[model samples]
Target: MSLLFCEVISAQQSLPKIHKDEVDFVNPLIGTAITGFAKGLDGGGTMPCVNVPFAMTNFVAQTGESKMGRMCYQYEDKAVIGLLATHQPTVWMGDYGYVSIMPQTGSLRVLPKERRLTYDHKDEIAKPYYYSVKLKADAKTSIKAEIAGANTCGMFRFTFPAAEKAHLIIQGINLNPELTDWANDYKSRLKRLKGYVHIDTVNNEITGYNPDRQSAQLGPELKNFKGYFIIKFDKQIRKYGTWDNKIIKKGSEEQFGTRMGAFISFKTLANTQIKVAVATSFISLDQARSNLKKEIPDWDFEKIVKDTRNNWQQQLKVAQVNGVTNEQKTIFYTALFHTLLFPRQFSEYGRYYSAFDDKIHNGESYNDYSLWDTFRALHPLLILTQPERINGMVKSLLQMYQEGGWMPMWPNPTYTNIMISTHADAVVADAYVKGFRGYSTKLAYDAMHKDAFEAPDGDMQKKWGDRDLWTSYEARGGLTYYHKLGFVPVDKVRESVSRTIEYGIDDYCVAQVAKSLGKTEDYNELMKWSANYKNVYNPATGFMAPKNVNGQWSAKPDSGFTEGTKWTYTFGAMQDIPGMISLMGGEKPFADKLKHNFNDGHYRADNEPGHHYIYLFNYCGMPWKAQELVRQHTGWQNFRNAPIGINGNDDCGQTSAWYIFSTMGFYPVTPASGLYSIGAPQFPYIALNLQNGNKLVIKAIDLSAQNKYVKEVRFDGQLIKNHIISHEQISHGGTLEFKMTSVPQKD
Candidate 1:
């Protein structure tokens, strides 16, 4: 048995029992504050979104006024433009399919800036499924608005001060006009960039269409891209009209032009409430109405909010941890909340509109993949907590391949071709290996194999193939020389080192699936190719350097690496850590280098490449070092309830997943490997409710901020001789106890 896990006395003491609801810790504002790194951008850019788990659409208050301001609802901003139904995954990528609505008591303004109202943040209420704010449009009028939504439908209730011309305006904003040539040519842009709004004064409703002109990137597969919506109001409409180009034409039922929208005015007494229900569909206007009817048949604002909260509570109940501070619980649950937001449900009812085929398909379809970011930790966390959801996600990816002829790289309601490498390979393989096989494994393997072996071609290449079918290998830009040179030459690609390392991990994933399917030749070949990351290692500089096509390292070696530095890529060889340590001259030397990297601030916790580096200490036979590093990084980089709490973009919850795993005292360094590298638990106890009708409990005795080192570890009373635990052991369910101390435990 390893001396690190030698038998030690367990401390016995009765601790305070913390219930699930007692925490009330899912603060949407925890990561909302802007930070230094994300300054002027979405600093700590987490959306204070109000939606159900995996809902197709989310409602957030739009506060910023600039073009880049669309990315964040800065807490410091004093004005509220309106509320929007947005599909904004991160501030960096911007938003799509956006529809804005504002309530006013006096004269109506067509533009967002003119109609913006000042609101106090202290009076605002934000919850998982509900958001409310009191906005003052002028000196005499104040509008209290509350919102809630489920699936493809949402509702808004507004209390208006008694006024003669109380009105509600609905507008569609052109989020991405750069995709069209209209930006350069004003006349052509105005003529081509058009939307439609039709008002029904008799039915007190408004219907419109917003076409996504950014289809140049979706290729021939996307026949048409449009979002249709139907909004019904509860109050009687005294007057209605349409607006175009900042001109309001009263009593006009229809309008078609750039910057088009509709408004409905009503006369109401003091404290009179107005309710609005809206449904959106990519299929047609009729489908949008049907969605509104099915999801929310009546004007019950409170019921929707209550139901949405219950829905979030049910999902949040999967893992319950006790004996943590209120602030710690807040951070943990908020991180978990962000992880469940993406890979959103794009399909409504039994029908889904595919950007790949430009046809409405009958089934559940999910979009907003962000695979390069989510595949690392988010998908793996879902595999453990929400296996059934993972099954659906796998099926969704395979369906995309069947429709588009290639798997998605980073899908935002369509094949975006954003980021690098086909990481859908890793997500699918990880699910299959973790025993979630509701999807077709054979079909998945075929997709993964095609992405790995096939050359860049029409609508199938790595980047921008979705938009331009004729995009060349050089234009696609990610390890294009992999087949010929066995490694991505820095001279040939932009992010050459990042491409090689990420591709190596993707290759390892495909090998796992191939081996499971009994393809011995392919498995062995891929396994060999997976080790190609070592080719980029430069022992001279002790960093992963870029090499030329002729196999010669760069003279100065570009310091401005891909999204990171050369030091970040040095530990990118995650598949072969033992070999990586050997290349650095053995365990002791590797440990010393890692220490210098962390102590000297070379190990970045802000990006994805170095996410698994802190856990690499486990592979070097120094579990104690891994424990302290986890604690230090978690403390420094993460926060409890501040807006700028997170150091970087959530990356669709990958950053949060690191926190969830590290706080739980283990992390999956190699996600699909099914092994979790052990660390020190932050809490005294954590109970995860498994889907298999079992509970996995973790207990840490004498656990405190100072006592971050693990003195001894045991699983269900048996000593854990190794610094690792398997998925089978955790999922089967049992107690894992840890003894902690201020001093490190020597092996």
Candidate 2:
């Protein structure tokens, strides 16, 4: 190694570090650039608003147009309109809510169908705690924003020359799962808002005039809006228009021009700001105030913004990386930021309404359960860094069982009836194995058993398990087809591979949970379920190849893995890699084959399968190989712009989080599993301040291009020969020393 490399490695041996809270590393624009097979920008609905992750008052409207891409927004004819509380599945999948306060200017009207407003993408600005956009108009009006926890506040400082009329309009445009007719008693639902609002004075006032504003029924044309929530304003800072007195929910006869601010009359020295605050579950006005007070307790907007950014920075610090290019850092960390954005905690002030029971309860509430997507990687990352939150999440899930009457695989408040497999079983199992507390293993195991014994919807598919559980229509038609024939049919193709992998992962979680609970019989039974992977793996092709009912592999090579080929699923042996090694014949061949797979670019580093597998080498006695792979991968995966820069779908942040962990020289490959498999370190040194008030210090000795492999290893202060580190050791928090060398240590 060169002198500089020696210097870096030497420094690594004696490096100092600090906790995540000490760092200032919040950057929300990381994965904002859209890339991969998915379309649309990499924009995200998550904001560095407040608290830890879910404590923000409200997230701004990520996009107003609905173009059906990563961040696509749908617009009516021309009007820039309302916010849905739901934003879709990141920038990859088209699903999400736009919550509270839609602002528009000029001729306000229902936006035309999915006509994405053309804005200068260059003018868009997103920061750790703020966002700004210049709308696509004749004279693009500029909009800037900040948020408290659940309430979003914006400053649309419009600039205008002498104009016939300059207008500002506020209208509630449409809702997803679109509403039909305005219930006369709609106020009952609207009245749910009552929370504390901490402001300078008591008068960060809300004016609810125009209650009877005229509605324009646009037929079944619009997706969901019984009647529009239209409010007209005539503040001294800007011109205002009267609410149209026409109530028509049938067709689009309303003129678009008259809808935007009636007209605009400009004054030269003109500037003004509007504060829009909205709460979703408006039970009473007091609840709204409480929500506001909890989120924004002070008048210092800048302080709140700074605090929010600082929150993101703290989480970003949990795992740090170096040596990669700046763009790589931006993309990796930004994507990490997005992964934690949603399933936001809708509960306010330690109390939240449970969708399961339809009753108000108390606890640290969290939502936006992207269980289907996040179960793969995001939750696993959380287990390593934010394990404390695991208990509360478990409790909340238990509460879901109490209220909703079953363990939810893809749980939200109202419904738990979606997705293919029981992955929460995996999440809970992973948590238990990692040694999380607060809830009982027995209870959790019971919930898991209930879920699996029951059908997809938590009801026993047969007479209380007297017979085999009837798989849900989707599962039966899809999974059973695979079980019978070994290959998924073509018609049920959208999520074929995902379904297969998920089934295996979920069953493995079930087995793990059972084992953890000491229910050996159940564990043995579930272990068989874990063997579900065999149903799909086609050894003839040396891949997790698809098969049909009669046990014939798909003639096509790309049948089993989702969004990837057989090369990816070849590593789907997450549940039992030792068995996989045995099947592959031995550690040497398995290691060699894996190196070849990744070297031939068989590894989908940007995809979900691309995650957590490098560390598999450690289990096979090839830690050096795992380290080299990690070092090589982190060195090259650099995309710095918005969505366009990231590899594959951000999957929230799992993909990037994988890179982050791998570069740090270790990863929690299997969720809820306490062991962190070591990988190669890119940084000279890194550290993590464990929640238990200790530190995880990793020093790469003699680490460099020429000295990347470990010649020796030590734990605490004792020398060791293997790569695996126990959860107990990590939790106790001490130095982990890796003495590096060019060649593997002498056996």
Candidate 3:
């Protein structure tokens, strides 16, 4: 080896060093850019937002009109429209109750196109709790905008040149009179989403409300659902006006209707700084004002930044990260930051407006449950990093069941019922199995059990698109057929093959919960129902193939899946891998099939369906294959420290969750099973500080690119033969040591 290679190897063999100030390693911009797929690299589908962990609202620089399938801020975008307070969970989810604020100089520009201010990436700073940029309003005028975010409020500091017509525009998303389309495209700006605005010149404030949610068409008509915002300024408003579309009524104090907005104009000295704090609420206008007064009591932008940063520091510090290069550290912590941004806290000040019941109630609540995507890995990660909040999250789900009459598949505040099957069962079951309680297990089991047998409103022979009109709760799309025929029929259901397999996985989770509650009959029946996955398996193709209502396999065996293909779902029945392996002919054949799938470029690490596919090798006894693949994924290839880092939609943190788990050397391949599949640890040493005063340390001796596979695994100094560890072992705390070697440990 050359001298450089020798030095690198020596460094990798050195003792792992403890890393501090991990918050500084977070790069919010990692998944913000949409790039790389065409160039044979990972593409991203996430926005760079400034917010606290699980914050109700996210504050971000708005580049253009963005929501569900579009990013608000793209790295390629050359201008900034405004600073938006958004509740968009992911690129695949719609934003609800959103608004924006912008600083303007000279003539006022209120519309998104007119208000566009140019900015360069080099002049910007983006972090979880903070964002700042210098926007050129004119050739000679550059407005410096800095932002700090809290759970429900956002603080802004805008520095301006000596301009007499300096203005602050408070705007509402114009999406009320929306087009009845998936894109949420508005036909005309003249007749847009109805909004309300009030300019309090005496108090130097502006208040507004927007009652538009793009996901509303998929849920109950919420009577009192709207975002109420209270903006407090630390300066006097000399002149003010409200605007509706292109009609700018000067000196107007209040306005309510299409495309509503209010602007306050005043003279400013050279380099004069104006600070504004804004808080939002779903309860009422009074609550919005209260949130503003309570969360941000004064105009201390720096203090808020410092406190929020410190809050993030504590959260990021929970994992005592070590080993790897600084680049890996950035990717690691940034993924952590992404994972904690969803299942957002919807409750405000101990009270919340329930979108399901369409009323305000006193209790803890969390919205945007993205259960289908998150239950796979995100919630599993939360069980470790956010143990204290688990009860509240479960209670929130119970509240949804109580109020809505059913447990939603994907609760975007209410039920979008977006994804297939009921993975919410997996989340609840996994939590309970991992020793979490407080919510009634009886009710939890009932809710999950109901989904296994109970059919939805439209029953079967219905093409329930991913996001259809919310006419009724779609608990289990083809449950009627799956319950009777042991499989969902392709002729009856749109995504028959995928649903059959996923429903099987969900049923297995419900069975575990039932077994824990001592309901043997229910356990046996659910367990039997869980094996319904066999009905869809085509031994001829060695794939989970679609079958027609006539009990015959479809000609196109690979069709009818959700966001994936046959190669993705064939081994996706993670709940009963032994059964899957048996069906696939045997252990050797199963392992060969897995290798075939990976070698053929059919395994998509970019999506959730194939997320657990990487761990299937452990079952068939080729864990070194899993170890190698895990390293390639957790390393720089899939998870990058750049704008186009992640291969696809972070899916509200599932992508990041996979990285954290796989890198830490364990993955909850089958949630609710209470067992984590072992993968190769990229980090030499990782200290996980559990909430219950337990410290789990993961050590990888001599881990490097060269030492790529695990020679042997030991937990608490005992050798692990099966390449698996239980939740109890991890939660109770102990050391998990993996001896590394350059050669694959096929044995």
Candidate 4:
């Protein structure tokens, strides 16, 4: 390419692509090999659940503890019990809940104490959708389990040793202590276990719990899976269901275990061979069922698993970078896998519990939209391939607003109880601008406005109240002087810098949404607010230095932002990078600054804010800088095993997700806006299958540890100089090639 053409190409739009059937490109276990603090169950290093995001009822447990030091649960405990309906937060939070169910043999009792369930390594079977475990038994007892959303169905097949002392002990309540004991002193709690099944599906609600629901409705002499309960209601009638446990036991602890069948079947289905379904609302059980029946109504479990795996294959296909090692493939696909975990599926059998109202409603909605982490990348990832789900998510957000009074900031089952900044406006605005038409634009706009007007609920509200005033105060133009200048004070209030950074994002989001909707006045107002990032700039340090109420830079500048420092926080002005660049003087110095920043050991790669900063070099006419950093980070890090090995907090896989994409050679640079800028590919070959029936393929040229920097670039075999890629081009399909260099390709 000529220099002029290269200049133009660099200035013009550029994007990448993945193929439709490039299944081999996806290896959902890249980063798991070195799961550090995530060791055991905590580090979250497990096999990919080849299904919809959170589609599988359970993730497979490896043989040992995760790097986080917790032993994962196994299906083949001493006895077969029920599969739990609740779980704790995935990445950021630890195991807050450890609900377990187990069945016993020898006697019909509640197992008044805890018991040890042991299993051999060879007795377990795990696939994408199926899992089974053979407990520690001589012969005859085997427990198999699989997930179908709202329910976990387990089938136990057992043979008896013909002992007169056979019995079945049902342990109902599972606690943290119990799980710890089960992982360690398994022999200690084998006798006096005390628990029973609630036996009531109708009595179960995601939002509310009845104390009585904990007690067994069945008397002590319970037999098989025969148990029942009633749902109490005030006015609104909702679709209900039933739960039952059935197990045939024999020959007590005279060296014997029992088998059990646990199921949670929806009311819409009369078939005993149950199909598990979930809905996002109460009014649309039929719609959910229609979805289920149309998509997967037949009892072919294998087909369903295949279909689910295909779904993941297609989604992960959005950005495939090839010619990498097996470990790279695993990390890449696994990161993609983690991204799909949440906004989980709540639309069971065409009906779902609503986040807007504390009631069971029905509508064609996707319930598990966790905007907290998803708004960053998952939703954008979906928009590129699974636009259909994006439509559903948009409509769900709108309905949530209509029924609950505002768009959810951090939604749970029945409340949009706000947590964090009201960034829904950014998501809606981006979706609308991106041409996602699943929901009403006007309604969405109104919801965004409503969400902006209110304070988020809980600790978020108490921490960051009055968004407008905060923005105004911060945007007054001379932040440093205003601080030497006595505006923000330093004390126990560690929230000062964080609040500023957050307000900047909010302002940018509001501006983007307003501009998209053609509200010029609102747009102008928010644009000024968006520029509030200027207040934190420190020319001396060339970072977004924090200041005190006196308008002077904080003297004690040690980790100013919540989890990052001034240098790390400085480059986070995504909303107005040009402004940030201008603040650094010009492109040359700006590029130099970025290069310097990257090598300073200040960039927290494990944290979210610093994730895409490597790509920022491309915007500054120094794309090679991004290439070097990308390759270096991928190469230097131990992709598997180690606790502090993570660059920062997992932040629900955001950092890992970033690594997954970067190693593949691109990223959704502006997550809320659905834009992926190109970078250097760490691998020699990669491909992604987009839901839009297109593929994104990336192949590195002369790639190696020494040849990390990009020597040249091409899109679809055409020579190119531009380093950035767009969302549209990636989803549509094409190959991106990067020629490597032993030294800087400065020419």
Candidate 5:
């Protein structure tokens, strides 16, 4: 009685039939083995999630931190704790309001370390909509679990072996079950669980709430933040129990402690199946039940899988690529699938629980914005490919502004202040500049203005480093210094070099919003401030070195950079690249400095800061260098059809978005700017089903391994110059063709 795994989203190893669906090309396993750092082969911190696009929740298999440092699941893990209902946006981020379930055939073990089951990679299937695995519960017994889901509800169907009696263990907390103090310090243990669970035998149901947000360690703690879950079983519960601190209560119905959970057993026949429908909500238990009733009112498991797959198919059909290899197609769709996973829907049904205000609000909401990383490419890509989400995303930002008093730099569903800058300004301005005004432009401008101008409560009291933790809200740290001195002093804030560069970019974005709103005074002011990055440039040293409070440059060239060397932020002043070129002496010196990073191994594809550096070559006269680098990065060299596909944190799809744009022969080097810096197209022919009901077709004639450089480019039969295209020109939908040749064309 083996369940059939759907071939439409199956691995690319073998095709049982001719599958023409674009979802068929997606292989979620490609990025599951990601590591936490950029130097590793698998640093893209992506999970093989099963959920609808931009879902409120996704289902994944948990590795219990016994494997990868902080990831829930890695492709190479020999065993998994259980299937988890999680809101973890990426590998580096903490998973909040999560729970796990595992089916067993023997005596119940409450601890994840005790009940872990071994499984082979061959026995697993992961897709955007569904995931299934066969686990060896013991050497003598085995169980199969199939998971499918809607936006917030997930259904797990388990097939059990007949003789041993079926049992389901529910993990309601995020504590390390193997902690040594559970025996000696029960009270301390209870305080740590931060979760509660209840069992109702008569109704065959379980309900609980977990309010723990692990990321709050480095940010403001929200007292009202909680994740509620409602679970219903199709099969009757013959027996039930709860566990805490190694003590098992065979009939207890509820528990309110850490490392605590409940288990239920059912009488079953050989090869009998049991279905558990679980619903989650940040609002309340009632809302969780409501979501469950709306999404999974029936016991049929395959119905959920079918509906979700159809949803993904329709979602992916927005972009189609022809004349590419199956491997390339798999990588492309997998990257596409990754891009749609984040800026998750924070609203449940019609209501949302705001961590910012600590209140329930009736409005649209979206969060888990990795703004520092995403504002570069992910948000820009969504501005085009996922136009439907643009307004809602902007509205969500405005909502955060109204509730939290400002837009979050990194909203871990709330303001974590994890990353730097106010790049939400870029997200808002990019959407508006793309002609999407569904949200209030005035409100967006205010938020951007607040981000740009308003200093945090204590802007000068202390250096606000990356992990300084909830010191009011470090919106534009050292902003006061920037206003007075043009460049932030390293003594005033950490990572001053990058801060100046990023703040300058955000200034450009805010200025764009201001210009659109006819705020000429603010626009002129911001446009001037946008060039503030020039102050950090040490012309004698040829690096954007940090400046001390005394206005002396750092002796070390690589000092004061964020997550990279000084070379990383040297050319990061994208708002004024032409000025940056002149500052670097000329295009040749600027190009040479850019080339030095690539040649000397300072350019990082594993991180977001330099992801745009290759495209910057297009800004100079020698786009030929950019074209070849595009092929090298987008092809088998970096993005591959393997577990280590992406070499960096997908950063909620920023890494993947880079692939999509680079392979499509364009990129948004500057966010608020409507232009896409041109690069070489990977595919011979590509088509984007734009949001404006038109198709933008790109053709790369004579494209092959031998012909990797673009000889010339054209738009609507007009020869393109300076290697750029505007949104107004491309969004209306016309052919942008490229003539490819083995040798670089001087023109």
Candidate 6:
């Protein structure tokens, strides 16, 4: 046997078994603290979301208020108003189709502010599936609230102190009122917000539907969309009533125009615990009731919480790490938890409603595709760990294309053309080349081809028109300019350089799929256009500057980058790193520029564009530098079980996905390349259980904080001569061993 094999076997046997429940390591409150950063821009703008993996409904406690308050659960808030059924992707985009539930005593205050109760952080507990908080209304009355849920149904258990008047108020309001108003102004349309609530006193149940008036923020297609929900309680109602616009009405049910809700008041003894089950649907109230019956029929709160925890545990067991500090495990598992929270399941049972088509369909559907952000890492991570889920995602995307005409960029249960480019092309093409066959490849290719070549007109044009709020670069944002001028013009587009570079990457991904599918002509055509990023390269400035239609460079070259500087976008050509390096006159210049980016504070780890910049050193033949930078970024900018752990918005789990890939000792620099750039591994041992019944085990010898650099790397008893590994090698399952040392390996 080889000496390396013997050493690996000995190490594997010596390591402790990972019997600690993975769910215990996940701290949902790690990123929920409110920092001074911009509302959506805050890196810690995450909620203690309690739900099943990718479940359509998330149960979270609301703390603070903001113009864009999607992440309403802030750690620093002195009090929590209510627990809400939220479909919020992030604070930047805002939430939709949500209702609030608050438990109050002593008096019946309908407004949120009057009913808000103070809470201490020490009295709160948060996990992937369960969350609990102690609410103190006054010196005399206190309430203990806990929440847990399945796919579409949530269970809320509240323990109240003995009181004369104990009430549970259920209200529906616009979560993002300011953003909706802003959208109304931009679209020049004021759609009335409609809400309805019907109460059944005999059954002790309340059912309603709230139609969120579409705003320019969500595009025109989603205007006046509605979502229905059914709420049932276990405790008997001593008295039942309703309220409209804070006006007290002694009745069983009431429906109001814009601001309306229903409440139930009952007398309870001390330590009386009441449980409520809430089920929601995009289809109708009856479907909501059916979902509730199918998902959570009984009031077994403890069983539901246990089952939810076990579900998260099973999902998290896909990758098991050992020999790391407790802090590192917390960060690792928390990131893994965040990565699974988005692109949620939109279908309920066997039925779904598509806001894109304004019709009901009979099948499973997925929504919240933050493709512009997730195509980089989140989707690729799923392709490696959860290929079956990726298959479902691809099938869902293709179905949306069939119904809506164009593939989605971002969809909050509907197509919301919010971000920069059509990167769904990259996601579909990546999944296809990676051999995920849940959908029709021919249909996917046809859809991508049409999106790439054709222009929008008629209804399609109207849908694409809302995307022109920021830039009028083209009807579909720079497709015309990219075809005609080889690059998008800064004078015409809002974020010209960012769109051009991203489109080039997307084209490269499409070309890969075309080549694999035997479309020689299409492959050659897309490959030529993939080099269009070269046209925007500014030789003298050492940056990817934007150019006008006249081929003149923008005098203010940095003006075209999105949410970042010129230096940030300069290193964004992940599809062609060698080409990018050669444009800057070779390896030494490229390495120097990268170092300067970090030294001069040009590299922003808080955003999407600069995520892969640290790993670029491996392509420059200096993996040691990449190792140093990874440690620096992970230690300094990332989390350590604190509220401000994440340095940027979760962005539908893209930021956390970066942390997961980096800590696992590699990252997918190019989404479609099937290649991972090796970096420093945070854990000494990692076992990733692939869906194909294979296990990829990664072990680091003598790994510690100081010994972060890799001295030697071997795969399956053979030495890896380079600093790159392929997805096929990892997915097929084998042992990858890394020898660690404090000193750098100059050779």
The TM-score leader among the candidates is: 3
| Residue lDDT tens for model 2, 1-747 | 333344344554434465333223345544444434344323232322223454323444445433223243311123334333333434322322222344443443333232223455465555545655555544534433333332322222233333343333333222222222331122322332111111111242322211111111100011221111111122332332323223322212122211121221233322344444343332234554555455555445556567666776777677656443334345556656665665555555667756455567777666546565566567766766777777877776767767667655443333423444666777777777777877876788877786554433322222111112123222222544444444344333434554555666666677776776677987776666556666665555556665543455557657544556767777775777787787777888888878888888677666666576788888787777776677666653433344344555556565666666766677776655567776666656667767767778888876676877777778888876567777778778888888877886535
Model 5, runs deviating above 4 Å: 1-17, 35-42, 66-69, 177-193
Model 2 worst lDDT window (10 residues): 211-220
Error in Å for residue 162 of model 2:
7.1
Q: What is the C-alpha RMSD of each candidate to the true structure, in Å?
A: 4.6, 8.1, 2.6, 11.1, 4.7, 4.4
TM-score-superior candidate, 1 or 6: 6
Clashing residue pairs found in predicted model 1: 33-643, 33-644, 217-467
lDDT string for model 3 (1-747, tens) is: 222223335555653467358898899999887665446543566777887889998999988766556667888799998898988887667788888889999998788788889999999999888899999978987999999998999998999999878998888756533333564544433343578888887777888888877666666767678899888888888788988878898999999876668898888888999998888999988988888777788888988888889889988888977645566678889999988888999999899999888989998999888888899999999999989899988888888888888877877678886889888888899999999898998889878878876888878647676777667878888888888899988887888888989998898998988888899999999999889999998887788999998899998777789988888888888899999999989999999989989998888888889999888898998998998888777655577778878877788899899989998999999889999999888778899999769999999997765887999899999999998899989999999999999999876
Minimal lDDT window, size 10, model 5: 1-10
Candidate 5 lDDT tens digits, 599-657: 89888887888888998887778788898788777766567677877776788899999
What value does the lDDT take at residue 259 in candidate 2? 19
TM-score of 6: 0.93
TM-scores for candidates 1 onward, in order: 0.92, 0.75, 0.96, 0.69, 0.95, 0.93
Name the lDDT of candidate 6.
0.79
Q: Would you list the rank order by lDDT, best first?
A: 3, 5, 6, 1, 2, 4
Candidate 1: Cα lDDT at 165: 79
Over 525-584, each residue of candidate 4 has an lDDT whose tens digit, in order, gives 666766666776778877776666556778876534655677767777777778888999
Give the least accurate 10-residue stretch of model 6, judged by summed lDDT.
Answer: 458-467
Candidate 3: clashing residue pairs, number: 1
lDDT of 5 at 693: 91
lDDT of 6 by residue, 1-747 (tens): 322223333554554466678888899988887672434446567789899999998998887533344367877789988888888767766566777789999889877777899999999999888999999967967899899978888999999999888999988654333444443332332244667787887787888887753323455545436778888889876576777665777765766545568888988799999998998888888889899888887988888899999999989989898765556677889989999888999988888888678788998788988887899889988886777788788888888888877788777666665767778898998887777777898999987887666654431223233334422212247577778889888776668888788888888888898889899999898888888889999998888998887899988877777778888799998999999999999999999999999999777788899899999999887899998887777764555578877887778889888888887788989977878888877677899898779998988888765677899898898888778888888889899898999998878
Off by over 4 Å in 3: 1-20, 39-42, 176-182, 185-193
> In model 1, how large is the Cα lDDT of residue 515?
92
